[model samples]
Target: MFWVVAAASAVVLGVAATLAVVFWPKYPALAFQPLADPSRVAPAVPITSRFAAATVRGDRAYFASVSDDGTLGVVAADTGTGERLWGNPAAGDADDWQQLVALPDAVVAVSAEDDDRRRMVLLDPGSGKPLWDRVIGDDDTLLYAEDTVVLVDREEDRLLGLDVRGQGRVRWELKDPGSLSGSRTTTVLAATTPEDLAAPTSAKGAPFAEPLDDDRRIVQIGADRSARVIDARTGAVLVPPRQSVADPDDPVVAHDGTLVVAESDNARRIVAYDLAKLGEPRVLYTAPDDNTRFEHLTPCGTDRVCAVQTTSSDAKTAQVVAVDVAEGGRRWAWPLPDTNNLVPVGDSLLAAQNTTPAKVSLLGADGTVRWTRDGVAARLDGGNLLRFAKPLSTYTDDPSVAGEHLGDDAVELGPLSGVRPATCAWNTAVLACVADEDFVLRRFAG
Candidate 1:
């Protein structure tokens, strides 16, 4: 009886050992602690009022916005601070304001009553204190690059480039300035006509949109739709041949020195101009149908172009295609429904609906829909759709009404231009222009 009892005890011990060995946790054990109740998960904190524009700076977020009456407010916060950051630090009323641009060392707040009375105010992100304020060009033509700002004299047809720091002299002004726009890292200033215009014409009538490559050379888009690569310091034209641009209205320069232009003339083709081999055109496909009209073309990294094709018969449906600019071939194509407008959001595409603002959907290079956000619009960086809830009293108004149109009375925030950038910082997954009443600087999962 004693041996049987001992043998049974040993059998039980062996079974227990086997169970423990099979179910043992690894080096990183299951250290998770359950909440008091199964339903007691942490609640999501949604963004709220008083924050303006939220831009990424290094690892933290820097947000800026206007108050009830055009006052400037700036705040900085980190994701480590639970779901939200500390409140804003800078707040004050201004008569009129332009846009907030992020610089390498500081943020620039441009305000003006008019172009002749424009002010470029620099602020330190840490303190939101005013570094310096200077009068730039007249209000009619104020353009911003990363660190540089260009002021154009509309009446005189001249260009003045200023370093926002106020410590350096203004760079050389183009005597016969044409059309210009600012990129994320560089400035594009093209001299279209040497002679001054009696009346302002559309920017398309102006000459090339040159990529101001650093401070060394100013790349030109020539009269024949060619790229005139010029030495920035010496003013010598490098390549003089005109490129066969498909869509002059929508042109993008790739990293490999290839120029991709939308074939607006032919909605089915994208014409590529190689800077290395000028005068040659590479053709890319858009859709099977020829009558389809192509609108927006966002670049995919340094090579491919994201094409948004529109059909006049079906206003709601859009055909999106990916084109390899170098090889001049179609990568893939897919049809998306209920899209009013198309914009680039991070690495994916955003669909702006006329009835319901805008939302994002991640589109892969192989034409796959990865993720999507439904019924939310505010890709504010492209400058479309003002964050203000109420429509502006007029397009020329200084400040906007927040929650006014959507049923609240808060300060107005923008007369925001309807332009979006091709690329944004890596940390920024989605950017939205929300009504100022619903303003806060916070992070959300992509």
Candidate 2:
């Protein structure tokens, strides 16, 4: 009777698992899309100075530095017209500066000689004048989107939304999820019911619960080690997290409302949760075997690509395999050797290979080599120039025009030429990485 009951339970669990997959948000299988042939070239523009730091936003650029005479200097570039909009380093406190974000309208500056003196400043991109300034009490996680900056206070466990113009507002707040070994280990902090929660794994082999979400969503892991999703907006349980055949591993957020969580227990498989709908997660892609480990999985437009290493005795290489989140399929694959970094350029992948001297390889969605340059670090800019380090080389995606542009192409600026890229915005712009050594900002063209 015991044996019969055990078999019956196993069969029932298998059926439930199959039903869960069928009811989950479905996506297409994986397939490879071909790429176009690549063109190789180097920049012809005159080289200039070296920069301590640099970044590219939408179409404008901002660079800041302390001059020899103890003054700050800033340089701005118009990405659309390729003109220098503003080039003045004499803005802000000349002594110390840091944390620049290119907003839609203005550039924000964070200044502090020490951690206790943290201050944020908003500056006009065109005029280089301060708009608003505020002293955030703590060093919080700041997210800049359109007009709002999302600041998360980990210590207080609160969320604050501030206007780019220095208007601070409290969006929401929640208690800390608590330590894994706390008394509320299996207790649900903000779920609909006990069954609606999923358990998170602990190093002690005991599962704990973590309260993770904002005002719109709440997630909890249960004692059984299941992950569950809850809708904070409606206070309803949507996706009931399940224990994977694999253990809980890395969880990544996709461009769309998808949560990609992976486990490598029994095998190498990843489950992608489409938050748009409440159901089981679809198995997006699986590795060849347990030995194939994941390096990085990043969003490429609406879809995503996972870089995996197939282990062998010979020289191990990295392959970027694209996965469809909505349709549930594989799109294409790009084989990369020395794939140091993969920067997304719109719908394609920009693979950076650091050889003996380092080089940039631009690959199309179809796996074709669009362009290659030697001894330069390159990044895609607005479908036009591949911003290379050193004497900046601006390569055109248009093959016919590429030659013409290359002729006119001189990295007009050098390393210190100070052409920090800016994101063109309407009202507030942000510059990242502000420090006493260098300041970077994004400027709006208009």
lDDT of the candidates, in the order given = 0.44, 0.44
Which run of 10 residues does model 2 get worst, by summed lDDT?
A: 396-405
Model 1, 360-446: lDDT tens per residue?
A: 444554677754543332332211111223222211222221111111222233333221111111122222222323322222222
| Model 2 regions lying over 4 Å from their true place | 1-60, 67-98, 111-118, 134-139, 174-251, 262-267, 301-315, 368-372, 376-446
- Model 2 Cα displacement at 321 (Å)? 1.8
Q: Which tens-of-lDDT digit does each residue in 188-246 have in candidate 2?
A: 22222111121111111111121223223445444345555554433245665555422
Residue 329 local lDDT, model 1: 76
TM-scores of the candidates in the order shown: 0.55, 0.55
- Model 1 ranges off by over 4 Å: 1-51, 65-94, 112-118, 126-146, 150-159, 166-168, 175-248, 251-256, 266-268, 276-279, 286-290, 312-314, 338-360, 370-373, 377-446
